[model samples]
Target: MAASIDAYQREIGPTAGQGTESRDGVLSSPLERLSALHRISQSATASLDLDSMLMTVARVVRETLGCDACSVFLFDPSSDTLVLRASIGLNPGAVGRITLPLGAGITGEAALRREVVPVVDAVSHPSYVDYPLLGNQPYRSHVSAPMALRSPDRLIGVINLMTIEQRTFDSEEVAFIETAAGEIAVAIENALLYSETDAELHNRISQLSTLRQMSRLIASTLDLPQVLELVSRQAAELTRGLAVEIYKAHPDDEHPPELLSHYGAGDDVLTDRVRHQVRGMVDEVVGALGTVERSIQVSPGQRVEVMALPMLTGRRAVGAICVYSEKHLGDDPEFHGMLHAFSDSAAIAIENAELYDEARRGWQRTSALLQEMHHRVRNNLQTVAALLSMQARHASSSEATVPLYEAVGRIRSIAAIHDVLSSGSISETTVGVIAKHVTDEASITTLPPDTRISFDVDADDVWVSSREATVLALLINEFVSNAFAHGFSDRSEGRIEINARVSDDVSVVEVKDDGAGVPDGFDPGETSGLGLQIARTLTESDLDGSLSITRRPEGGTAVRVTFRSRRLPEDTIT
Candidate 1:
């Protein structure tokens, strides 16, 4: 077995200084050593995959050196430690589970020194460290070489070799191992660079996708509180923050910044120290109309960072969004860009919601004023009607009382329109509502008490502008008045029916009375009566309509009016 081992080492290049003799008593050539190194170099860079490349290199190095074990440790800058990445001959489970600090053990010592360290008896070395999980191999000899790149002088890791037998490595063997370590370092650097680039690209895509989703959510509502809440929650998620707060800056400087929304942790769960720090950040950002960042130590050896970005619309500072985390997020340019983008979107949403709220309040004020004006107009008309009614009661002649009574009815008809307008939107009302009010008023006031005159009003639910409704009401009152005065003058009981129909943008209102018909050959166009003349003039001019009064063949009078039904505009309330 010893002779075979010697022959193998001679062919593969000797790793320990033995007698300068091969199995056949011939010296190994320098060409054989170069061939061994070339093989090791090729194995180191065989794959771009870090784990595969490291494992392959470890196996090749162990075989080339005729050693019992080889292991590769990679440097973790974040933790300032060397982690076992790949190994052969050691316990496979320990490959990635073992770790050592920069100057903790033999491997770490070599990494710190940037040189090769050899131990004749690893168990007796003062700097040696053992891992029970790696299993006991009774390795007596060990060598640790640090892997590094020269141009930039960056430390990659350390490569370790162990032997079960007591052996001493020569200068040539150490040089060979150092060259292999150099090749491994270059491969590791390349792989790490590729990984970092890939991670950055993936992070960018994820951030942009998150921003898009957040923008859509923010724009979905015009409610100010809802928008602020959405922005706070999404901002916390995008930044991976422990907590987030949105603060709205009051336009008046006397009022302090208001916390509009909060996400992540409840206020009772957060430490007072954290809340204070966040408040400070909010004040600074809002006051300066810019971004503010700070780092505060929450506990011993624990620090948290806070970043607040202003929500700006044009030159106005509307609010600020603050994110809290344990990471040094303020140092990252990508995080800044993402936060700024989200902040801009949040600002626009807040501004739009505020504008909508302001406009709604203004409209409410204007509507209230218009309603009050309608009420006053209705009151004045009713007063006029009452005064005229009192005047008719005092009149001595029936002829004088008749004209005054008719004027009072006309005034009341105009007042009915204002009464409807005051109760709701002034822009429009239903024709049916106006007809009912006018006909009911005429029945109560104009019909004689001794003679029973019943009124039946059937009007369609046709909507018309307030102006048209007023004219229609007066025309209906005039027709009803004329019926009460002339058509039912000598009748003990009479029926006055008012019917209105709307079709194809035209309206037709017919007031028919089962009472005395008009005098023979009566013409409404030439009537000297003020009531008929008023109705005819209103139908032609204001209502853009025509009126015809004809004696019904069944022995009563029917007055019909035809007009274009003008609907209110879209923005006007009906």
Candidate 2:
């Protein structure tokens, strides 16, 4: 008994379902009979433990058949190939090294046909081959038997054996092998049941993980682009998925997966394939309505689960989550469940982002309105000054009251600026209008017809506000008036030129004359009073700027006022 045990254990240890033969005579000892029954009992026991069955098959074939080796080859229905799953004979490497096509070898042929191949002599059989690992042993005769532990109708795999010497197995040995193979089929069926149970546990774990991470991401950000990017990355990482894609559902197209972002381990070619499928045509997206199961068509006809999670901001679908997978993980139930749960978070984040965008747009509109109002206010003030002018002129006595008259002219010049600003659209304006009006109003054109004076305007029309317009216009009037009063008193050739130009976001207004220059070291802020004080106040306070009085290269003093224009900085101010 002990010797038989040693032979079975040592020889079958390396043979994985390897087929061997037993003696032709019946089992003479009670222990031998006992071992055969134990083999059948292990096979008959109903358990979903496929691994335990493989181990039992290896041990039983060696002990009962009294063979050197045994091996089990299971038929994978998807491929129709006999995959060598477990073995007890041959090298440690060769245990899983071999695979036989269905109907290709002795074991494969037997499994494919669900028949028994009992070879009485090894050399006579056509299907037998000299497996290298068993060359050192005295293998001669063998048997191949088919068994199905999964679907009873389908042959699961084949059980094979090899013997030490050339011999034929009798009726008793054949019956024992047949009964043993049937028991193995039962073991296989049990193992598969266990696989399904395990697979379910894994799916539940995965679904929970996805829900947790998705919650944090949807709450963290209001930026639409950023949120989309994060969603793609998180889905891939959490699921250990082959690929992940996020799509935005638009009005024109249903499936236009606005590939917000993606992350994965594959190459650019592979990732690009995912990009195309998620953004599939509109018909495809609409087809996803109410219908649960969907798949994105990939380059190699791979079936990736297409999940449509409409990023519902209110009732409409603002976007969707188009998830994909290259590998068919049997986690479909959990994957579908999680997809539905995460839709709420996705919708909330999208809503928040859209609201923030609307608020920003409103703020901009209000700012434009305020700027327009300021421009008009400034223009209206200038117009009031103009009305005062007509009144002052009718009230004036003569050139004898020239100082009083001069004061009124200055007042009315500023008044004209306020009127222009008030009448026109003030937000978009030009100070040049004010400058031209001032020089024209204070010139000989308006003075007595005998004391002739002409105005020369230069430079482009520099557009500015009615506020800046009034300040700059009044200053020009004062400076030009002073030149006419003092320097051009007994004029040979007198001309006042007002030039306004803009540079480096600043507006420059220059008043020049071909008369006597300013007194040695004269500052308009210091010397020219009443009008000058007002001019200084208008420049520094009203315009929030500066005034420089310089001698023109041609002779007269040019009063240059530099100031800021709210709209001037932007070439296209609305």
Candidate 3:
């Protein structure tokens, strides 16, 4: 311990104990507390709990001096005042005057000069003010030292050694008090970190809870105004804002946006109004104004200028939440982060509500259109089937009769699609129905009953509007009929796999055959069949996709077609 202090003395200059009278017999309490503080100082571990660390420092001060009053004052460097943070054995009323200046008293003078002051008589000192601790009794001896453990080298507070006795506080006692002062500074730092950690954790939990509740509320309701209002109110409360206001934008005049839904304008009306008046601000600062998700805080003079957070619905900026106050209530990095979390929670709810409203309207319109479409398509295909039956009856040769019967079978396959579409509440049917219909018509069912064709679908039910769905169904039918004609001609045991999935707004369908693969010199586009040509036209130009054919690694030909979605990619694929 002595050797450590000797090394510290060289770096910090010799202690006040270097040359002074030592008392042989004295109170052991001061030395004992000093020894305990020495052991704590030797440690290099970090503390995260602020209250416990600050309370421990106060305990050491009370035990060391054996005094009835001890308090720790930390300097708020921004506020530039010695704030009375933690106290022991001191009345709450006495804490206000606990804050002292740079050279006001014995403690202040020691801090200002960056040295220890050991005054045997307080009456002799010019700066000795009557502290509330001594009551009406005169103060005899006092020892004080400046705190310098923390960075930015300013006096945090002073640790004062007070005794009512007239005996001097010798260099030995002064040395112990000065080292104790440094340890108090570290305790102050740890306490500040603990306070920050607690506030951050609390804000994050509140944000997550608000998002969960908002999700449930939006899912069950269709009222647009109510959805907007709930998002704004919850955002304000979650962030602990002074006030929150929201705006809803219009489609045509989105260049100069409109206010949609707003709450809490009493705190700052100007800030609530400034979001729409952002033409100049956006041009001068932050450049782009297309979509905003970040928060902005501007202070003008002593008052807060604005605390603005943007709310986005989908890729567009539908609205924003603005909070205002007369004073700079929240002016830190952590506070700004909490505001951003609040905005994120609100925006997601707004987007979900908008999407739900759209889906409800889409299904109602599409269901009615599909029923009409099924009636018209069934009539047209039956007309073509009746003409094919007429052609089969007029044919003279057996060879010609076989081709006429094949044409009539294709017409029946088209008629079966309307049956599936008209049977359910859904306007669309699976690719499974279309594939199974074509294979059955082409007499691929002549094989054993156990042999099956499988449809391996990996995507959600993608609702294609009328024309697109019909074209895609017919396109898949042509490919399967062609596969049955040549590839599975002599195979009694076989499997056909139809795989479909959606990726990045593109829905892909891959039809693979486990039987004989594509022949050596056969190109699909070179076929004279009108069925293959129609499939190629719909897959390329109509569906906005490309067709690919590959031999599978396990001896099969896979026909892959990828098509784009009409809408943007979202949580729901369709």
What are the RMSD figures for all models against the true structure? 8.0, 12.7, 13.9
Model 1: residues >4 Å from true position, as ranges?
1-73, 83-147, 157-181, 206-220, 237-239, 250-252, 265-289, 296-304, 331-345, 386-574
Assess every candidate by TM-score: 0.66, 0.53, 0.49
lDDT tens readout by residue for model 2, 1-574: 3344345457545432234233534465657766776755665463456666676667566656666667777777887887776665445455556767877767777877777787867666787665564331345676888886544476777888766566576666666677667777766766776688788677667667767766776677677778766677766655566665555556665234455655564554345664555555323544444213356555575556654455555456555655555544345655655665666566676667667667757755665565566456546644654555555566646643565556656666765665565455544456567767776777632355556667777654688754566666678778877777766877745777778888777878888887888766777756656767877888888888898887777788878888877764454322
lDDT of each: 0.81, 0.64, 0.59
Clashes of each: 0, 41, 3
Please give, for residues 280-396, the per-residue lDDT of candidate 1 as tens digits: 777778779878888877777767778889998888778788887877675687678788888988889878877877887887788788889889998999999999999999999
lDDT per residue (tens digit) for residues 1-574 in model 3 = 3343234234433222223343333434666655766644533124556545554565555454453234555565675556555554434344445666667777678877888888777778898786544241333666676767657665666655444345565466567667777776665555566678788787667767776777677566656678878877886676555555565445565364445666665424445445544433332222332323323343343333345566654455555565544444455666566565556656666777677778867876776687668767877887887787787779998678756665666666666676556655444554555555545654432233444555444333554533555666666666665556555766755567765666676777778777678765557677767766777888888888887766666876788888885643332323
Score candidate 1 by lDDT. 0.81
| 1 or 3, greater by TM-score | 1
Candidate 2 CA-lDDT value: 0.64
State candidate 1's TM-score: 0.66
Highest TM-score: give the candidate number.
Answer: 1
Clashes of 1: 0
